[model samples]
Target: MTRAEGRPLRADAQRNRDKILSAAVRVFAEDGLSAHLERIAKEAGVGSGTLYRNFPTREVLIEAAYRNELAKLCDAAPQLLESMPPKQALRAWMGHFIDYATAKLGMAEALRALVESGVDPYVRSKEMMLDALASLLEAGAQAGTIRADISATDMFAALTGIALASGKPEQREQAERLLDLTLDGLRTSPR
Candidate 1:
């Protein structure tokens, strides 16, 4: 089949692509860049040929895996809102962000390869994250549960800092405590 730029994949091809990406994330998280593509294909129940057909190179696979995780994180905003109160939803999403940061750290080497190859995986990460957070925060503010003065950008920066600081296993407890403190600051004070 001819490769068309930005063309939608056929149904079965789309399923294969999804399987490969899911397998890649698991393998890369467990084994990093040293994880074999053939093994990923095996896990996805596809042949190595199919894996290569979907991802031409390891870097491509890595980028797709990272993007897939980001998509999951971004997609959770609405789901969380539907399941919990606005403030609780934002808190739960923050916890998920922490988990995402941890997983991303596990895939650091692969991410570095993307950077060396001139791809900026973080290009729109902040904007998308901020938009998601802004929606939740705005909802909370409307309910009078969250402070109105805090900007989504500032909240994101703070969360990123907390993620970075608590990235290490040894600092996990401290990081959690810090997260609570930050959340406390965001809460509306009783009059």
Candidate 2:
């Protein structure tokens, strides 16, 4: 709801921004970074002017879309914990991770373009993901459902490897199996 410069967006502006980001994610994933700005605007149900006001440029939109997806994935950790048992929450969060990975994979070209443009969209990505994983692991460990020996860093690396290996849509079955395997490894006892 706030701009990168920390200025709060008006409610309508926020809505438009959210729409544009969502649309951009889908559009970029389907059409790549060279996707037309007008197409994105139309997909968002906003005018070109509104989209321009919100994003300013293709790279800016790509970065925002990717960051938005990352935030959603990271923010799901506590919410998942609040709604389910810790181990269950971890499993559910891993599903969310797969979804995030799919989107990231879909936008790979767009992100590469953003990186080439001198903006590191992943600047806080690892830290945020690790924090989320740590919170979930700690909760599960305290609940005695998951091993306390696992480090968030280790889990993250494993998850990243799985994502890299099975991130495509057709590879979802394999990704789920890998996730289950990873979760099994994290369990205090095999279940």
Candidate 3:
């Protein structure tokens, strides 16, 4: 596990870290803060010592899980752009945002507890989300498929509103319909 300055982690160490994060996400999603570290270690197929070596406390693990999910959502922008048209990419990302919001809502209690304990688990979350949305909007603007007047901040706020209003299971269909309406508003007008 040795490295030079800012060198990347070795393959095995990286794999172990990824496993631990994945296990933590599942455990936290299913059992919240009360999820056992030993269970996460077992699920990751790693030893309990390894889990402790990576995440010293429950808060650390929860924070890491939250960050990992955010990173994955952010990272999807490039892949989406590569695989689909700019407008399609934006639409797909909106769908992912819904999933992200859903998961976060599910973890609300634990997250609030972490915040109450003086830990800012949401550090850089807004910036990261804005950046991701910016990428999608930039692509759409360049493609002439979306209006240039709308800022990423505007879209972000709209998405957040949609998430909050449609967060319940019974409201998911309505939320998606609202998303489509929002996307329609962002589209360029025909001559």
Candidate 4:
């Protein structure tokens, strides 16, 4: 991956950056905005200097972690389609979406602080999500496994509703049930 300055990171540097972002997501989710950078560095198996070099500030780290999660979620659509049928791919992707939503919820406080700093961590998030959803819906429609009339915006809204209602760790079963119900409703022939 390229650095913010458009320079390509070395292999080791990219690995370190990935580790830092993964650790930052987990640490910030668990400890909120005031989590220690040293702890994140330790969790990432990287030095403090490495973390600081990759992300100079707490806001930068938080935004990077969230954007990393979002990128993974949106990128999963094509990967899932390659691995399974369109309907099944979409179903699997719903689970990923719920996981993403849960992580996003966990980082809400950190994200709020980032937003209050006059930076929008969510820039392009909605469009990116809709594009992913639209691709999945189009694939399913072509396969005749999903209804043709559903809009990506409507599907996104419904998924957001499901996430908000049952996206917690303890509520995963409920979330799965809700997702299945929603998916069933999207079928060409409702089950």
Which candidate leads the pack in TM-score?
4
Query: What shift in Å separates residue 142 of candidate 1 from its native position after superposition?
Result: 1.0
The TM-score measured for candidate 2 stands at 0.93
Report the Cα lDDT for candidate 3: 0.87
Q: What is the lDDT of residue 79 in candidate 1?
A: 95
lDDT of 2: 0.92
Ordering by lDDT? 4, 2, 3, 1
Clash numbers, per candidate: 0, 0, 0, 0
TM-score (C-alpha, index-matched) for candidate 4: 0.96
| lDDT: the better of candidates 2 and 3 | 2
Model 1 CA lDDT for position 131:
87
lDDT of 3 by residue, 1-191 (tens): 23346778779877887899888877777788788899999999999998888788888888877887788889899999999999999999998898788778767777888999999989899899999999999999999999988899999999999999896556889889998999999989853
Task: Tell me the tens digit of each residue's lDDT in model 1 across 25-88.
Answer: 7788789778999999999989999999878999888988888778778889999999999988
Per-residue lDDT over 1-191 for candidate 2, one digit per residue giving the tens place of the 0 to 100 score: 68779999989898899999988888888999678989989999999999998888888889999999999999999999999999999999998999899999899999998899899999989999999999999999999999999999999989889999998889999999999998988888755
User: Where does candidate 4 have its weakest 10-residue lDDT segment?
Assistant: 182-191
The pairs that clash in candidate 4 are none
TM-score of each: 0.82, 0.93, 0.85, 0.96
Clashes of 4: 0
For 1-191, candidate 4 gives per-residue lDDT tens digits of: 69778989999999999999999988988999789999999999999999999899999899999999999999999999999999999999999999999999989999999899999999999999999999999999999999999999999999999999998889999999999999999999845
Clashing pairs in 2: none
Query: What are the Cα lDDT values of the candidates?
Result: 0.84, 0.92, 0.87, 0.94
Candidate with more favorable, higher lDDT: 3 or 4: 4
